[model samples]
Target: MLSWALTFLIIAIIAAVFGFGGIAGAAAGIAKIIFFIFVVLLVISLVANAVKGKAPKV
Candidate 1:
Protein backbone atom coordinates (compact mmCIF):
# COMPACT_ATOMS: atom_id res chain seq x y z
CA MET A 1 0.00 0.00 0.00
CA LEU A 2 2.85 2.34 0.75
CA SER A 3 4.38 1.36 -2.53
CA TRP A 4 1.12 2.22 -4.25
CA ALA A 5 1.27 5.71 -2.80
CA LEU A 6 4.84 6.08 -3.97
CA THR A 7 3.90 4.91 -7.41
CA PHE A 8 1.16 7.49 -7.63
CA LEU A 9 3.53 10.15 -6.35
CA ILE A 10 6.00 9.29 -9.09
CA ILE A 11 3.22 9.42 -11.62
CA ALA A 12 2.18 12.85 -10.39
CA ILE A 13 5.72 14.12 -10.70
CA ILE A 14 6.14 12.82 -14.20
CA ALA A 15 2.76 14.14 -15.27
CA ALA A 16 3.54 17.55 -13.88
CA VAL A 17 6.84 17.59 -15.71
CA PHE A 18 4.96 16.88 -18.93
CA GLY A 19 2.42 19.63 -18.18
CA PHE A 20 -0.49 17.26 -17.57
CA GLY A 21 -2.34 19.33 -15.00
CA GLY A 22 -5.40 17.11 -14.55
CA ILE A 23 -3.51 13.85 -14.41
CA ALA A 24 -0.98 15.23 -12.00
CA GLY A 25 -3.67 16.57 -9.69
CA ALA A 26 -5.60 13.34 -9.71
CA ALA A 27 -2.52 11.22 -9.05
CA ALA A 28 -1.48 13.48 -6.18
CA GLY A 29 -4.91 13.21 -4.57
CA ILE A 30 -4.89 9.44 -4.90
CA ALA A 31 -1.40 9.26 -3.47
CA LYS A 32 -2.41 11.34 -0.44
CA ILE A 33 -5.39 9.09 0.22
CA ILE A 34 -3.30 5.93 -0.06
CA PHE A 35 -0.60 7.31 2.24
CA PHE A 36 -3.10 8.21 4.97
CA ILE A 37 -4.78 4.84 4.71
CA PHE A 38 -1.39 3.13 5.04
CA VAL A 39 -0.56 5.16 8.15
CA VAL A 40 -3.91 4.37 9.75
CA LEU A 41 -3.50 0.68 9.11
CA LEU A 42 0.03 0.70 10.49
CA VAL A 43 -1.14 2.34 13.70
CA ILE A 44 -3.92 -0.20 14.07
CA SER A 45 -1.47 -3.04 13.62
CA LEU A 46 0.84 -1.67 16.32
CA VAL A 47 -2.03 -1.22 18.76
CA ALA A 48 -3.27 -4.70 18.11
CA ASN A 49 0.14 -6.19 18.72
CA ALA A 50 0.61 -4.22 21.91
CA VAL A 51 -2.78 -5.37 23.20
CA LYS A 52 -1.70 -8.94 22.52
CA GLY A 53 1.30 -8.36 24.80
CA LYS A 54 3.82 -8.90 22.04
CA ALA A 55 6.49 -6.67 20.55
CA PRO A 56 5.70 -5.42 17.10
CA LYS A 57 7.80 -7.20 14.46
CA VAL A 58 9.14 -3.84 13.26
Candidate 2:
Protein backbone atom coordinates (compact mmCIF):
# COMPACT_ATOMS: atom_id res chain seq x y z
CA MET A 1 0.00 0.00 0.00
CA LEU A 2 2.74 2.38 0.95
CA SER A 3 4.64 1.30 -2.11
CA TRP A 4 1.63 2.20 -4.25
CA ALA A 5 1.53 5.64 -2.69
CA LEU A 6 5.20 6.11 -3.40
CA THR A 7 4.76 4.94 -6.96
CA PHE A 8 1.99 7.44 -7.55
CA LEU A 9 4.07 10.19 -6.00
CA ILE A 10 6.88 9.40 -8.39
CA ILE A 11 4.48 9.38 -11.30
CA ALA A 12 3.11 12.73 -10.26
CA ILE A 13 6.55 14.20 -10.10
CA ILE A 14 7.43 12.92 -13.52
CA ALA A 15 4.14 14.07 -14.99
CA ALA A 16 4.52 17.51 -13.50
CA VAL A 17 8.01 17.78 -14.91
CA PHE A 18 6.61 16.92 -18.33
CA GLY A 19 3.87 19.53 -17.96
CA PHE A 20 1.02 17.03 -17.79
CA GLY A 21 -1.24 18.98 -15.51
CA GLY A 22 -4.22 16.60 -15.46
CA ILE A 23 -2.13 13.49 -15.08
CA ALA A 24 -0.06 15.06 -12.36
CA GLY A 25 -3.10 16.13 -10.41
CA ALA A 26 -4.70 12.70 -10.72
CA ALA A 27 -1.54 10.93 -9.66
CA ALA A 28 -1.13 13.24 -6.68
CA GLY A 29 -4.69 12.56 -5.60
CA ILE A 30 -4.10 8.83 -5.87
CA ALA A 31 -0.93 9.15 -3.82
CA LYS A 32 -2.73 11.02 -1.09
CA ILE A 33 -5.54 8.46 -0.91
CA ILE A 34 -3.13 5.53 -0.87
CA PHE A 35 -1.01 7.13 1.83
CA PHE A 36 -3.98 7.74 4.07
CA ILE A 37 -5.21 4.20 3.55
CA PHE A 38 -1.78 2.87 4.43
CA VAL A 39 -1.73 4.92 7.61
CA VAL A 40 -5.18 3.73 8.60
CA LEU A 41 -4.20 0.13 8.02
CA LEU A 42 -1.08 0.55 10.12
CA VAL A 43 -3.08 2.03 12.96
CA ILE A 44 -5.59 -0.81 12.78
CA SER A 45 -2.82 -3.40 12.85
CA LEU A 46 -1.22 -1.75 15.86
CA VAL A 47 -4.51 -1.69 17.73
CA ALA A 48 -5.22 -5.31 16.90
CA ASN A 49 -1.80 -6.44 18.06
CA ALA A 50 -2.18 -4.52 21.31
CA VAL A 51 -5.56 -6.10 21.92
CA LYS A 52 -4.04 -9.52 21.35
CA GLY A 53 -1.28 -8.71 23.85
CA LYS A 54 1.38 -9.60 21.31
CA ALA A 55 4.72 -7.83 21.11
CA PRO A 56 5.78 -6.54 17.73
CA LYS A 57 7.77 -9.15 15.93
CA VAL A 58 11.44 -8.45 15.57
Candidate 3:
Protein backbone atom coordinates (compact mmCIF):
# COMPACT_ATOMS: atom_id res chain seq x y z
CA MET A 1 0.00 0.00 0.00
CA LEU A 2 2.80 2.39 0.83
CA SER A 3 4.55 1.41 -2.39
CA TRP A 4 1.39 2.15 -4.31
CA ALA A 5 1.25 5.60 -2.71
CA LEU A 6 4.83 6.22 -3.76
CA THR A 7 4.07 5.03 -7.28
CA PHE A 8 1.16 7.45 -7.57
CA LEU A 9 3.29 10.25 -6.16
CA ILE A 10 5.90 9.63 -8.84
CA ILE A 11 3.20 9.51 -11.49
CA ALA A 12 1.80 12.80 -10.26
CA ILE A 13 5.20 14.41 -10.39
CA ILE A 14 5.84 13.17 -13.91
CA ALA A 15 2.41 14.25 -15.06
CA ALA A 16 2.93 17.70 -13.58
CA VAL A 17 6.28 17.98 -15.30
CA PHE A 18 4.60 17.09 -18.59
CA GLY A 19 1.93 19.80 -18.01
CA PHE A 20 -0.89 17.33 -17.47
CA GLY A 21 -2.75 19.27 -14.77
CA GLY A 22 -5.77 16.95 -14.61
CA ILE A 23 -3.82 13.74 -14.42
CA ALA A 24 -1.42 15.19 -11.90
CA GLY A 25 -4.19 16.38 -9.64
CA ALA A 26 -5.96 13.04 -9.85
CA ALA A 27 -2.83 11.08 -9.15
CA ALA A 28 -1.89 13.31 -6.26
CA GLY A 29 -5.32 12.83 -4.75
CA ILE A 30 -5.04 9.09 -5.12
CA ALA A 31 -1.61 9.14 -3.50
CA LYS A 32 -2.96 11.07 -0.55
CA ILE A 33 -5.83 8.62 -0.10
CA ILE A 34 -3.54 5.64 -0.32
CA PHE A 35 -1.13 7.13 2.18
CA PHE A 36 -3.92 7.87 4.63
CA ILE A 37 -5.27 4.35 4.33
CA PHE A 38 -1.84 2.90 4.93
CA VAL A 39 -1.36 4.98 8.04
CA VAL A 40 -4.77 4.14 9.39
CA LEU A 41 -4.29 0.43 8.83
CA LEU A 42 -0.87 0.52 10.44
CA VAL A 43 -2.24 2.24 13.50
CA ILE A 44 -5.09 -0.23 13.74
CA SER A 45 -2.73 -3.17 13.49
CA LEU A 46 -0.48 -1.78 16.17
CA VAL A 47 -3.37 -1.25 18.53
CA ALA A 48 -4.62 -4.74 17.88
CA ASN A 49 -1.21 -6.20 18.59
CA ALA A 50 -0.93 -4.25 21.81
CA VAL A 51 -4.20 -5.76 22.94
CA LYS A 52 -3.11 -9.21 21.85
CA GLY A 53 -0.77 -10.55 24.57
CA LYS A 54 0.40 -13.87 23.13
CA ALA A 55 3.14 -14.32 20.58
CA PRO A 56 2.53 -16.51 17.55
CA LYS A 57 4.26 -19.89 17.10
CA VAL A 58 6.98 -20.45 14.50
Candidate 4:
Protein backbone atom coordinates (compact mmCIF):
# COMPACT_ATOMS: atom_id res chain seq x y z
CA MET A 1 0.00 0.00 0.00
CA LEU A 2 2.83 2.42 0.75
CA SER A 3 4.40 1.40 -2.52
CA TRP A 4 1.14 2.25 -4.25
CA ALA A 5 1.24 5.72 -2.72
CA LEU A 6 4.81 6.26 -3.85
CA THR A 7 3.92 5.11 -7.32
CA PHE A 8 1.09 7.60 -7.45
CA LEU A 9 3.35 10.33 -6.15
CA ILE A 10 5.85 9.66 -8.90
CA ILE A 11 3.08 9.65 -11.44
CA ALA A 12 1.87 13.00 -10.16
CA ILE A 13 5.32 14.51 -10.47
CA ILE A 14 5.71 13.19 -13.98
CA ALA A 15 2.26 14.41 -14.98
CA ALA A 16 2.93 17.82 -13.54
CA VAL A 17 6.19 18.07 -15.44
CA PHE A 18 4.26 17.30 -18.61
CA GLY A 19 1.71 20.01 -17.80
CA PHE A 20 -1.13 17.60 -17.07
CA GLY A 21 -2.71 19.62 -14.30
CA GLY A 22 -5.81 17.51 -13.85
CA ILE A 23 -4.04 14.19 -13.84
CA ALA A 24 -1.37 15.51 -11.51
CA GLY A 25 -3.91 16.82 -9.08
CA ALA A 26 -5.90 13.59 -9.11
CA ALA A 27 -2.86 11.41 -8.67
CA ALA A 28 -1.55 13.58 -5.84
CA GLY A 29 -4.90 13.37 -4.08
CA ILE A 30 -4.94 9.60 -4.39
CA ALA A 31 -1.37 9.39 -3.09
CA LYS A 32 -2.25 11.47 -0.03
CA ILE A 33 -5.27 9.33 0.77
CA ILE A 34 -3.34 6.07 0.37
CA PHE A 35 -0.49 7.38 2.52
CA PHE A 36 -2.83 8.28 5.36
CA ILE A 37 -4.55 4.91 5.15
CA PHE A 38 -1.19 3.19 5.30
CA VAL A 39 -0.18 5.18 8.38
CA VAL A 40 -3.44 4.36 10.13
CA LEU A 41 -3.12 0.66 9.38
CA LEU A 42 0.48 0.65 10.57
CA VAL A 43 -0.46 2.25 13.87
CA ILE A 44 -3.28 -0.23 14.36
CA SER A 45 -0.99 -3.14 13.64
CA LEU A 46 1.62 -1.88 16.07
CA VAL A 47 -0.96 -1.43 18.81
CA ALA A 48 -2.34 -4.90 18.20
CA ASN A 49 1.08 -6.46 18.45
CA ALA A 50 1.85 -4.56 21.64
CA VAL A 51 -1.42 -5.62 23.19
CA LYS A 52 -0.64 -9.20 22.28
CA GLY A 53 2.61 -8.85 24.25
CA LYS A 54 4.66 -10.03 21.31
CA ALA A 55 7.72 -8.26 20.01
CA PRO A 56 7.62 -7.38 16.36
CA LYS A 57 9.70 -9.68 14.26
CA VAL A 58 12.73 -8.07 12.70
Give per-candidate clash totals.
Answer: 0, 0, 0, 0
Give one digit per residue, the lDDT tens place, for model 4 in 1-58. Answer: 9999999999999999999999999999999999999999999999998888966699
> Candidate 3 on 1-58: residue-level lDDT in tens?
9999999999999999999999999999999999999999999999999998698899
Checking candidate 4 for backbone clashes, the offending pairs are none
State the TM-score for model 1.
Answer: 0.91
Ranking by TM-score: 4, 1, 3, 2
**lDDT of candidate 1 over 3-35, digit per residue (tens):** 999999999999999999999999999999999
Native-to-model Cα distance after best TM-score fit, residue 2 in candidate 3, in Å: 0.3
The lDDT values for all models are 0.98, 0.97, 0.99, 0.99
Quote the positional error of residue 38 for candidate 2 in Å.
0.4
C-alpha-based local distance difference test score of model 4: 0.99
**Lowest-sum lDDT 10-residue window in model 3:** 48-57
Worst 10 residues of 4 by lDDT: 47-56
Q: Estimate each model's TM-score.
A: 0.91, 0.90, 0.90, 0.91
TM-score of 2: 0.90
